[model samples]
Target: MGRTRAVALVGMDAHVVEVEAHLAASVPGFTLVGLPDASLAEARDRVRAAMTSSGLGWPQRRITVNLSPAGLPKAGPGFDLAIAVATLAGAGVCDPESVAAQVHLGELGLDGRLRPVRGVLPAVVAAVQAGRHRVVVPAGNVDEARLVPGAQVAGAVSLAQVAAAHGAQVEVPAVDPVDPPRSPEDTPGGCDLTDVVGQATGRWALEVTAAGGHHLALIGPPGSGKTMLASRLPGLLPDLDDAAAVEVTAVHSIAGTLDPGTGLMRRPPFEAPHHTASAASVVGGGAGIPRPGAISRAHRGVLFLDEAPEFAPAVLQTLRQPLESGELRLHRAAGTARYPARVQLVLAANPCPCGNAVGKALDCTCTALARRRYLSRLSGPLLDRVDLQLDVLPATRAERRAGARESSAVVAHRVALARDRARARFQGTGWSTNSEAPGAWLRAHPPAGSAVRDLERALDRGLLTMRGADRVLRVAWTLADLAGAGRPEQDHVAQALALRSRTAGPT
Candidate 1:
C-alpha cells in the first residue's frame, strides 16, 4: 500500500486530497471511492490504460483507490496522475517515499501522455499553502504553475516521466512547454482616451470613477461616445501590484481564460460581456462545479455593460450582492464556492429605445410611456448603488475642434497621485480607496463644516437616499484626494452633489 497527494478544486478554492492505493491478492478489478464527480470516477479506466500503454504491467490483483477527505466533492480529470502514481507505488513500481511528498496535478491520455488541466495556479498555491513544497503538472501548464512563488514545480509529459522521477526505470520523450495562443482581444493596443473627441463631463466622470474605484452609469444617444469613454477607463487606471496580480491571475486561471504563456497579468483585466449574457454567465454558475463568470474575471478591474438597458433585469439585479460585498458566493448541491469580485462596474445606456431621445435631430418615435419604461428597465435600487451617473450629450462642433485633449498617460499620472494620497490617509485603517471606507467610519469622522450641512439638507429633502448620501460622501472624499486637500471641502461636496443630480431623471 502507498499514498500520494493531489488537489481538488471547487470553484477557485483548492482542497488537498490524499490519494491512497491498496493492492490485494484477489480478482482483478479496481475501485475508486470518495465523493468524486463523474469525470473523476472515470479515472480508473484512464489509469489502467495509461499504465499498460507505458509498458508497465498492471498489478493483476484487486486494487482500491481512496481519495481521503472523502466527503469533499471532487471533480475534473486532474487527479489521474496522482491516482496512477500512488497505484504504481503500491505495485512496487517506484519509491513510495518519493511519491508521497509531491502534489500531482494532470490528466492522463490513454497513451500515457499527460494532458493539461485547468486551475493549475490555484492548485499549486493550495499545495504550497498546505506545506507541500513540490508539484508535478502537465507540461502545457508549467508556466501557469510557475506563477505561484516559492513552490518547486516540475512539468512532465507522460506517466513514464512521472514514474521515472519517483525512481522507476523508464524512458520517455521529453516535451517542451509552448506558449499558449493569445486571442486578438488579449493582445495589447487597446483604445486610448485621447481618441475621444469631446464630452468632457463624461471623461471627467470616468476619471473620478477610476480614481476612487466607484461604479458609474452613462446615459446618452448612440453616437455620444458612451462606449468609447467606458472602453478607455481601464487605460487610465494603474497596473496591478504583486498580490493583486496573483489574485486576478488565479481568477482567470479558474475561469480557463488565462493564457499559459503570459505569466502574470500585470494590466487590469476588462470584461465586457454582451447584454444577452445570462445571470449565471455574468455572476458565475454552471452544472457540476460552478465556474467564474465575467464578474469574477473582472476582479480588480472594470465590468463594462454597454447598452445596459438591453440586459435582462434579473441579470442586472444579480450584481447588487457582489457590488456591495466585493465577493460572489455560489451555492451548489455539492458545496459552495466563493470568488473575489471587487470590480468597478460601468454601465452605458441609450437615452431611449429609439436612440434619438437626446440628439439634436429629435427623431425619437417612441411615446412618453415607451421612453419612461425603456429607462425604467434599470431599476432604482441598481442605479442607487452606482456612485457617478452622467448624461453623455453629443459633442458640439466647437468642442470637437477644441485643442488637443489630455492623453490617458497624463490622466493616469493624476489618478495615481490621488490614489497615493488616499492610501496615505487610509494607512493602517484597512481601507485603500475612498469608496472602500466604511460608512460608519465616515460618519464618526465626518468631513469639515458646511459641506456635511449640505449633505444633511439633501438627505432631508429626499434627493439622496441614506445609501446615496454615503456614496456622495465617498465621492467627495475622492474629489478632495484629487485636489490634494486635507479633507473634503464645500466645493468638493457641491461637485459630488451635481454629479449625483444628473442621475435623477434619465439614468
Candidate 2:
C-alpha cells in the first residue's frame, strides 16, 4: 500500500485527503472503493489507459484505491495525478516519500496527458492555508497555481513527466510568472457624466452614489438615458485591490466562468443577467453543493438591473439580505457557504406599467392602479435601503450631438480620492467606505455639525428608523469626504437626508 496527497472541495473550502493504492495477487480487475461520486468512480479506466500509454506498467493483480477520510464525498477527476502517483509508488516504481510532501491535482487524458481542472486556484489556496509547501497541477493551470504565496508549484504535461520527477530521473518544470488572466474588455462605454445635457438633479445623485458606495435606482421613461447612465457606473468606481481581485477570481472560478489561460482578473466584474434569469441562477443554488451565483460574482463591483419591474419578484427578493449585509450565505443540508457581495447596485426602471407614463411626449395608456402595482414589486423596505433614487429626464438633442464622452480613467481618479478619504476616516474599523460603517460606529462618531437633537426628533416622529438614521449619517460623512471637508457641515447633512428620503419625490 502507498499513499499520496490530493484535495477535494467541501463547500467553498478545499480539504486535503490521502489517496491510498494497494495491489495484491487476486483477480486482475481494479476497484475504487471510497466515498467517491460517479466522476471519481469512472477514473479507474482512465487511470489504467494513462498508465499504459505513459510507458508505466498497470498492475495485473487485484487493485483497490481508497480516498480518505472515507466519509467525506470526493468528486471530480482532480485526483487523477494523485491516484497515478500512488499506483506507481505501490508498485515499487517510485518513492512515495518523495511525492508525499505535496498536493496533486489534475485530470488525466487517456493518452497519458494531464488536463487542467477547474478550481485550481481555490485548491492551491487551501493547500497553502493548510501549510503545504508544494503543489503539482496541470501545465495549463500553472499560472493560477503560482498565485499562492510561499508555495512552490510544479507543472506537468503528462503522467510520465510527473512520474519521472517522482523517480528522481527528471526535473519538474517550475511555474513561470506569467501575466494573470483578465476579463475581456467589452465595448467601451460611449456615454459619460458630461454627455448628459440636462437633468443636473440626476447627475448629482449619481455623484453622491458613487462617492458613498450607495445603491441607486433611476426612474424615468424610455429614452431618458437611464440605461445609458447605468452603463457608465463602472467608470465611476475605483480599481479593485489585490484582496478583492482574489475574492472576485475565486467566485468566478467556482462558477466555471473564468476564462481558460487567464491568470488574474483585474477589473471589477459587472454582471447584468437578463430579467428572465431564475432565482437559483441569480442567488447561487442548484442540485449539488451551491456555487457562487451572479450576486457573488459581482462582488466589489456593479450589478445593474435594467427594466427592473420585468424581473420576477422571487429573483428580486433574494437580493434583500445580501444588499444590507454585504454578503450572501447559501444554506443547504450540507453546510452554509458565504460569498462576499459588496456590490454597487444600479436599478433602472420606468415609473409605471407603460414607460410612456413618465415620458414628456407620450400620454399614459395604463390605469393608475396598474402603475402602482407595477412599481410595488420593490417593497418599501427595499427602496428605503437604496440611498439614491433619481428621476432621470430625457437627454436634450444637444447631448446626443456631442459624441462619445469622458473616459473611465477620468472619473476613476475622483472616486479614488474619495475612497482614500473614507479609508483614512474609517481606519482600524475595517471599513473602506461610509456605506459600510457599522450602525454603532456612526452613532458614536456622528458627522460634525449634524443636529443630533433634530435627528433624535426625526427618529421620535418615525421619520427615520434606527437603521435609516444610521445610514443617513453615513451618507453625510461621505458627502463631507467628497467635498474635502474635514468635518461634515449642516448643508451636507441636509443633502444626505434629501438623498436618503427619496420617497418624498414626485412619481
Which numbered prediction scores highest in lDDT against the true structure?
1
Q: Candidate 2, residue 287: CA error in Å?
A: 3.0
- lDDT score of model 1? 0.86
lDDT of 2 by residue, 161-239 (tens): 8888888343344333222244444423454566655555666676667778888888888888887777777767776
**Model 2, residue pairs in steric clash:** 180-263, 180-264, 181-262, 181-263, 181-264
Name model 2 segments beyond 4 Å from true: 55-57, 168-199, 260-262, 333-335, 359-362, 398-406, 448-464, 501-507
For each candidate, the alpha-carbon lDDT, in order, equals: 0.86, 0.76
Clashes of 2: 5
Q: Residues 325-412, candidate 1, lDDT per residue (tens digit)? A: 9899999987788899999999999878888887453698888888989878885646777888878887889988999988999999
> Which stretches of candidate 1 lie above 4 Å from their native place?
174-189, 359-361, 503-507
User: Which candidate comes out best when scored by TM-score?
Assistant: 1
Candidate 2 Cα lDDT to native: 0.76
